[model samples]
Target: MGSVTELKAADGFKLAAYRAAPAGASKGGLVVIQEIFGVNHHIRSVADRFAALGYTALAPALFDRAERGIDIGYDEASVQRGIKLRAAIKLEDTLLDVAAAVGALKGAGKIAVVGYCWGGSLAFLSATRLPGLACTVGYYGGMIAAHAQEKPKVPVLLHFGEHDHGIPMTDVEKVRAARPEVQIFTYNAGHGFSCDERASFDKASHEQALARTLDFFGKHLKP
Candidate 1:
């Protein structure tokens, strides 16, 4: 359902991406941002899911700037390594990679972005900074609070876990108060509730959030 492809950033940095296309005509395009773990199986599956929903989806390997081909599992050691790699790359650089992905999907029509965990925060930042986006969706983005003051240039949707230790409700409240226009939802779950590969995965919450996300994209990314 998907294949690995190469993308060139504006800075001439070449990175890898997993691209998935719809079986028939595409309704639009979707850019799926990856978690700190990189564009692993889960991220590729995410792209395939969106592709099945009639969008051309692309998941870029953002960690390529610091270290290429990074795909790790959900372990304490892997978490630490992902954090270090994420820190090594600058926000501007990450956006450049995201922009490259968005450019790659230009032919597929109106484009939207969806991300998880660290990628979630990047999705929000992409809405605020990047051009050619119809909307963006973010799930449990711990760093979003830091950028609450920045207004998004496009429609934004966000999901959060009520008990996520990494992202406090205070942070969600801050974002809500700062950006009242953004559609935000909370679930009775913990961090990584949407990822089945994680121990914190909650099927009920994931389903609800995914429904809302798809609806949002359908509304905004219409031809």
Candidate 2:
């Protein structure tokens, strides 16, 4: 249902991406951002899932700028490695990669971004910085509060885990206060609650959040 593709960013950097197309006409295009774990099996599955829902989905390898072919598991060592790779790349570069993905889906109708973990923060930044996006969704982004003051050019929806130690309620409140127009939801779970591969995965929270996300996309990404 998915295959590897290449995208050239604004800087002319070629990066690998996982592209998934729906069986029939596409409802819209979705740029699925990767968590710190890179465009591994989980991210590919995410893109395939969206494709099954009638959306042409693409997940770019943002870490390709640092090192090509980065796919790791959900372990502490992998986390540290992912962090190091993320640090090596700049935010601006990541957004460029995201823009390239949006460009790749030009004829798929309206485009939206959906991200998790570190990609979640990138999703918020994409809404604030990039153009041509219909809407954006972020799940458990830890760096959003620091940039909450920055205005988004499109509608934004955010989800957070109430028990996420990395992102406190204060941060969520700050985002809510700064961007009152953005829809925000909190669950009674811990960090990475939406990820089935994580110990903190919460089935109920993940399902509820996914439903809301799909609804939000449905309303905003209309053809």
Candidate 3:
């Protein structure tokens, strides 16, 4: 169970967010970053799932800066549209929105960030740029290698699909070599393996990656 709420970024830009709270006491907070598809049903579901696991989870509508109330499907046209919207938005602005969400969750205790697709790269960037995050996890972040020189201020975990055409193994290796301190893993699936709504969804990879992510959060975010 989650609800939509408004949040203001550091720059005074108001955006929408989906927030879910644990039924009882919260162990910590989790910031779930959305894919290029926006903070759609899948992202909300992710927040709800984390809430059920005893964390107050929030998913900010990052695309709200470019276009508000954007919820699109997983089609070729939608993919192209998402890419265009992402290109129009700046990473610095998105990180500001994420910092806003993290500020809103301050009372929940230690905070961690996890993201998918474009949000995945944003999550990694948050670990390196933002403050107050305990750790970070990213899935299939194609842009991570380009920014591998950036050092994370906190522990970070990254996952990639071995068959992901968007992210080559060479890029993954580059990140690994450049940032040996960051934990990196690869699965036998393609891009978007964690997304059940996509054709690339792989149940085995999703389950395994989720388990590792939860364990990482438990170790890093728990009080």
Candidate 4:
């Protein structure tokens, strides 16, 4: 389910991508965004999950500028490394990587973006900034609170945890108030709840969010 590939983003910045082909012809394409932790095993698993659902998936290494081959597990030191990596990279460049991943999946019938944590912010940006995107989904995007003015032309879904310290319920309400048309949901879990590798992982919430995302792609990504 893993294929190493190269993509060119803004200013011809070359980055690495992990791709998993859907078991059959893809009904759509899923552009999976990575967490602040980088495109680690968890992100790869997400791509495989989408592929299992018949959507060709690609996880872009948005932190390629910070470190080329960075894949860290969730230990204290590794978490610090991830934090530094997250702070080192720029959001503009990250979005460029996302755009490049979308371009690389040109053969798929339609394209949707799903992201977690930092990637979640990228998902929101994709829906608002990138053209030709079918839809977008974000899980606990902390940065989105600051970028609340951005709006999606296509459909969008957002999943957040009520207990998430990184993103408060007030900010979620602000987002909802700003974009009433977009679907938003809240769970009792915490930040990074969709990631099984993280301590915040909530199985029920993750499943429900995944189902809603699949349904969104189904409706928007018509072949």
Global lDDT of each candidate:
0.96, 0.95, 0.95, 0.87
TM-score of 3: 0.99
lDDT of 3 by residue, 1-223 (tens): 8999988999999999999999999989999999999988899899999999999999999999999998988999999999999998888898999999999898998999999999889989999999999999999998999999999999999999999999999999999999999999999999999999999999999999999999999999878
TM-score of each: 0.99, 0.99, 0.99, 0.96
Q: Alpha carbon lDDT of residue 219, candidate 3?
A: 97
TM match of model 2 to true structure: 0.99
Give me the displacement of residue 215 in model 4, in angstroms: 1.1
Clashing pairs in 3: none
Error of 2 at 68 (Å): 0.5
Distance (Å) between predicted and true CA of 109, model 1? 1.2
Which is better, 2 or 4, measured by lDDT? Answer: 2
Candidate 2 residue lDDT tens string, 148-218: 99999999999999999999999999999999999999999999998888899999999999999999999
Question: Which candidate, 1 or 4, has the higher TM-score?
Answer: 1
Q: lDDT value for candidate 3?
A: 0.95
Put down candidate 4 lDDT per residue, 82-116, tens digits, no spaces. Answer: 88998997777777788899988898888889898
The sequence of per-residue lDDT tens digits that candidate 1 reaches over residues 69-163 is 99999999999999999999999999999999999998898999999999999999999999999999999999899999999999999999999
Q: Flag regions of model 2 displaced more than 4 Å.
A: none
- Which candidate, 3 or 4, would have the higher lDDT against the true structure? 3
* Alpha-carbon runs more than 4 Å astray in model 4: none
